[model samples]
Target chain A: MHEDRQQFIQGVRDCLPTLLGYIGIGAAFGIVGASSNVSLLEIALLSLLVYAGSAQFIICALFVVHTPIPVIVATTFIVNLRHFLMGLAIAPAFSQYSMKQNVLLGTLLTDETFGVAASKLTKQTKLNASWMHGLNITAYLCWLLSSLAGAMLGQWIEEPTVFGLDFALPAMFVALLIIQLQQQAAGKLMHLLAVVGYTIIFMVVFSFVVPSHLAVLLSTMSAATIGVLTKR
Target chain B: MTISTTMLLIIIGCCLVTLIPRIAPFILLKKVSLPKWMTDWLSYIPICILTALIVQGMWTAEQGKLIISWHYMLALIPTVIAALWTRSLAVTVIVGVVAMALVRMFS
Candidate 1:
């Protein structure tokens, strides 16, 4: 129980950077939702249940245009389809964890949390359910509360990115990624470079041909396949 | 802000769509054992996905074309240094925020 407490604390600590980013973006989402004429209660519910930032943001835009409900639902599914891959990627690590634990973990898994946990896993750090909950619930709370506050703040700021908060997502990803590569790439630097280089090139080319989200999924899956094939 | 029936439906619908994709794999894989190659492939996914995100996040899409945001690219210099030097997620994030703020303020 004591170690569980420690793991929980560590998870919360690991999520601190994610917390800062969430506060700004969550509130910005709230402001956007409010300004878009969605009610505070609606925004709150969306944040609580839907919980995907991009999906919720798109929902607000669609609400204004009165896009057909079926269309919105389909778009939401497509926009978040990448999560299936994310869940598959992280599942093996949680194999020892119970179904209940995996359910909760899967529910709260976001790009940031996945990257942070994956980065830690690369360091051979041990993670328990409590840690996962601490990391997830803390981020979830920040998102919920901040968005509610932003909804109440009532849309005075036109663009929250003026404070450069939008950079957090990419920054967090890059930091996790750099650490992962540095830890694992020591022996085969060229192999690592090839994988990363392939990803960038594929993403750029795919973006030109497909939607950006689809581009990300295609590039990631294919590049990882390449990493597997070229493994020595 | 009164909640409308339509809005309620939208929220509910969005919730289902969002949750299904996120939770599907966990449910499907619960009783199955993964193959060795699958595990190896999954191991590479973290880096691949992260790289894909960073590449796309640095660019803005317009009129079916991608335009680079020099501000973000400029700010990445310090952030990457922070990551390599300290390898602390929190420190790198703080440095990134400050670096981006400076980039935005100056130009």
Candidate 2:
């Protein structure tokens, strides 16, 4: 029991870096949501429930364009379907725990938390429900608070783009890719690079042919499938 | 037609779609067994997804042509260096955002 507490705390501490990224993105989200007239209560609900940054941002953008509700909902589903892979990635760690507990922990598994948790798993070679609880919950709270703060303070934060705040997500992805790579077995980096190469090609070809998000999903699925197949 | 009702409807749709993807995998995994080959595939998903997202942002498609935005690429240089050197996401993001801001300010 004491060990679980310690793990949870460590999970929280590891999330410190994500705090900065989440605040920048989340606050920007709030500013955008407010300007678009999305109610503060609605924003809170989205953060509390939807909890996916990219999807939330897209929701705000789609709202501005007066996108149809069905389209927006469908886009949100496709954009966030990757969350399934992320959930599956970490599922093994909590296999012994009850399904309810697993769902509870998985609810908070954002991109940032998944990256942090996956890295920790690679290094520690052992994982606990406690550590995951700490990481997921801490990051979740930061996202909610930061975006809400941004919404409430939107007047002052008028132009997050002027400061290149939008680049934060891509930058975080770049850093995460590099960090995830650092954990790959040395000689096997070729397979990882193959996946990347395939993704770039697929994304380039598909982006022109299909909606970009679908292209992205296709690229990920195809590249990852090829990656696993080619690995001996 | 009011914003509140429309927004409420949208939010309800979002919550269902969003929650299903995130939560269903865990619940389904417990109930059904996946093949060993499929499990091997999960670990590779992260790199592919992250790559697809980043690379997709680096270029734009124009009228019958493709163009790479050098400014974003230029900004990524420092971000990449910071990521590789410091290996800290906070540092990399700060560098990245500042670099892009500077790039925008200048050119």
Candidate 3:
């Protein structure tokens, strides 16, 4: 029991740096939400529930655009569909754990957390619920706190534009993409194909799409199809 | 909609969306094994999906007007550099934010 407690604490410690990043990004999301007429409570609640960086950004953008609720919901669903697959990919690692453990871990499984957790699993043979709980709790707390701070500060700062904060989301995404591309094990051709396919499809479809959701759906479907065909 | 009500609805909606994908695989695939072909395809999904999202986020325009401002171009430099060097999320965000602020100040 003591060993479990120690491992749990260690897991949280390992997750600290990533959690800090989540907090900063989450705070930015909160600021955007508040500026766009979303209440502080709403921002906080969404941060707690969604806990997804990109999805939250997209939803916040939709709010700024005054998009319909159904569109917003559907877009978020499509955008976050990868998380489902990610959950499945990692599920086998936790097969020996209880259902409650599975659900709890699932809630905390963001892209960063999954990458870290999956890598750790590869090096270590044992899978413990405590480590997952600790890592997730640390991330969750950071996200909540940063979002709250953003909400509070957002109320005072009328225009985030004055501080040039509006571009943070895109910048962050760009940085993440660069890193992802750098780590590709499938070779340069795969990377080029993915990039070229995505750009062409996104531009072509986005030009004529009525519901913006179609843009993401069509791009993903077409890209995945191309990836499968060319991978062989 | 009232502020609180909108917040509630958004939260509920996000929760529902997040839960569906996270839980769907476990319930449906508990007894079934994913075929080799499907797994191979799944391996590449992240790269493709994320590339599309990043491109859209970086270049998408509002109201048919392009925004290729100096600030955005300036931010890209540090973002790419930091991502290449550290692969640290915190560093990436900090560098990007700092670059934007500096660009806005100087240009």
Off by over 4 Å in 3: A1-7, A54-72, A115-130, A161-221, B1-3, B61-73
TM-score of each: 0.91, 0.93, 0.77
Top model by TM-score, which number?
Answer: 2
Task: Report every candidate's CA lDDT.
Answer: 0.83, 0.84, 0.67
How well is each residue in A15-130 modelled by candidate 1, as lDDT tens digits?
Answer: 88678768767887888888889989998998899998778888999989999988888888878887888888877667677888888888998888888788778766345778
Window of ten residues with lowest summed lDDT in model 2 chain A: A118-127
Q: What is the alpha-carbon interface RMSD for each candidate?
A: 1.7, 2.2, 3.8
Tens digits of per-residue lDDT, candidate 2, A107-201, equal 77788888777776666644788888888888889999999999988867677777877788888888988998877788888778877898899
Q: What is the per-residue lDDT of model 1 for residues B7-107, given as tens digits with 9 covering 90 to 100?
A: 88888888888888887777767779778899889888888888988887778677778898899899999999998998877777778878988998999
A best-first ranking of the candidates according to their DockQ comes to: 1, 2, 3
Off by more than 4 A, model 2: A123-126, B1-3, B61-67
- DockQ, model 3, C-alpha based: 0.46
Per-candidate Cα RMSD to the true structure, in Å, reads: 2.2, 2.1, 4.1
Residue A203 lDDT (model 1)? 88
Error in Å for residue A131 of model 3: 3.7
CAPRI band for model 3: acceptable
Better of 2 and 3 by DockQ: 2
What is the TM-score ranking, best to worst? 2, 1, 3
- Report the lDDT tens digits of candidate 3 across residue range A71-167: 7888888777777866665665676766767777787787666655654543453467788778878888888888888878887766555455555
TM-score of candidate 3 restricted to chain B? 0.69
